[model samples]
Target: MELDSEIKDRSRESPSPEVGIDGRDRSASTTRPTLILYSHGRTPPLNPPPDLKYDLRSIPNPPKNARDAHDGRSKRLREHLLGELKFVQKLDEVESEILEAMEAKIVETAEKLENDQDRRDDGEESRENGEEEGYESLEDEYDPTEAVLRVGCNCALGHHRSVAFVEELARRKWPRNWSVQLIHRDIDRRRGNDKKVRGKSLRWGGA
Candidate 1:
């Protein structure tokens, strides 16, 4: 059999390829997906001849001295496999570092997604509650025949405060658009029971 070096040179010299790991030029097929696995730099018995078409190479985790998985995806898969093998195989510091970083990155991504989902849920809940509670709305509380101008006076409170509020409104030259009437609250019980006395307490002005 031609040596691995002689085969490599022949490949460069000619365009024809019979796919074998050592014989094939690494540069020509760097982007192919197949992961040809080896143990201690030798092929396994079940391995097929090198010329077969293969995709998605599954590389076994490399030793600590084995630095830099040549292809990007290959490196990731190697590190992931190393992490899985941690319990079975005792890993060195270098392998431990790579596994730890990978784990941290995964955890961080999960936390970020969870926090984003929680914020969206909270915002939706707050919006629904505001809609239910009628937030910042005065329409339902408004009354066309109601007046809020009030003052408390134990003596003739309904008339005293009621009249004063109307006078204050006039002093300010407020718009007189609504009707106003004073409904005395048990004024007859406090003052004389005579019809004239009760009639004096009940008065009307304008809003």
Candidate 2:
């Protein structure tokens, strides 16, 4: 009994395992790690200190010869316009050829129609006079060729060129049996803006 009492007294005198720094009881520290932090909420100092001054220099200006720059720009603009004009002229020539071909086709079709009518009339007369057994109209034998006029424009300036070409072709009385199709390929792809003109097909029965 005396030995047990001595052990109990020693146990009471021992330092607690739950005590931490600054005399705070730390029962939670026994089960997990404890972190002791001291913060006064002070901002960090800037490197090199706030009293340091910076010396900045102005950027150099470009050459002040405005006439040279203007001349260069004007030359470029003239060359571009000339090249566009040449291209448009070529398109005009092609359009003229197409229009002429259309006119020839129209004349040929009209002549063929007239001849067919004459032949039909002759066949009818022959059938009535007992020279033939049946009268068949030549209209059934008509086989007209299909022609399509395709106009492609590649720039804003060329757009007007294409329109003029179409107008001239229309004025020339293109064949009723021919078709026309217009396409514009030059446009800013990023902006998604462009113009397209489609022509109606001209057939024998109706346009």
Candidate 3:
């Protein structure tokens, strides 16, 4: 079936690509996976860590220019950071892993569901013969299509490299239909609290 039109929130001033469907019609009878992309810093751990986490601290920080560093969402900063060969290579590697992980998870879920169904079928026969208790129903079981692909990228500050990488990843075309939730967990962290560590990240400027 053809994909449904992008859903929009009426309260927003303009249509934002930040939230939208990636492929198939979610409203259709069949379910699809939802990929959550998170960008964060090292100080705090995510409540539930992503299934796959990529570290961007190895990638050198972008030039500290006021215009670009002042805003974490600046296109110029993204361009500068993305221009690095390391960044491109890392993105390609991460994308491939994401696809592999999602496909593996889907297959794993399908197998689990199949096994559950088989058990339930056997249990039903036993119950009919007054030999067994009630079995777990499909309603209480996992949905195969609900396989999740949670990916996180983190750097020193979570302002530039990690945030930009997640944003770029969120924008890419994926093989499967997905509902995406993009998050920058520590982008707005206060600079005052950040103690300057020698030879670590550049001076905390703006996120």
Say which candidate scores most in lDDT. 3
Instruction: Identify the leading candidate in terms of TM-score.
Output: 3
Per-residue lDDT of model 3, residues 1-207, tens digit only: 011122222111212222222332223223355677888887676668789998899987887773344544566777877788999899999988987787566555555656766887888889899896565465645555576778888888777788888867755665424566677877767566665321112111010
Estimate every model's Cα lDDT from 0 to 1.
Answer: 0.29, 0.32, 0.64
Encode model 1's per-residue lDDT on 50-141: one tens digit a residue.
22111112223334344232211133433444354432242233224333432333344334445645666776788888744323433366
TM values, all candidates? 0.20, 0.32, 0.70
- The TM-score that candidate 1 achieves is 0.20
Better of 1 and 2 by lDDT: 2
Q: What is the lDDT of residue 166 in candidate 2?
A: 29
Clashes of each: 5, 0, 0
The order of the candidates by TM-score, greatest first, is: 3, 2, 1
Candidate scoring better on TM-score of 1 and 2: 2
After superposing candidate 3 on the true structure, give the runs of residues whose Cα lies further than 4 Å from its correct spot: 1-31, 66-70, 134-144, 192-207
lDDT for each residue of candidate 2 in 1-207, tens digit (9 for 90 to 100): 342233233332213443433345533321211111111001221222321111111111113343224321133432333355443465356545655544344444444555756777888788788787364444346443332223332222222223233222232333222333322222112123343322322212112
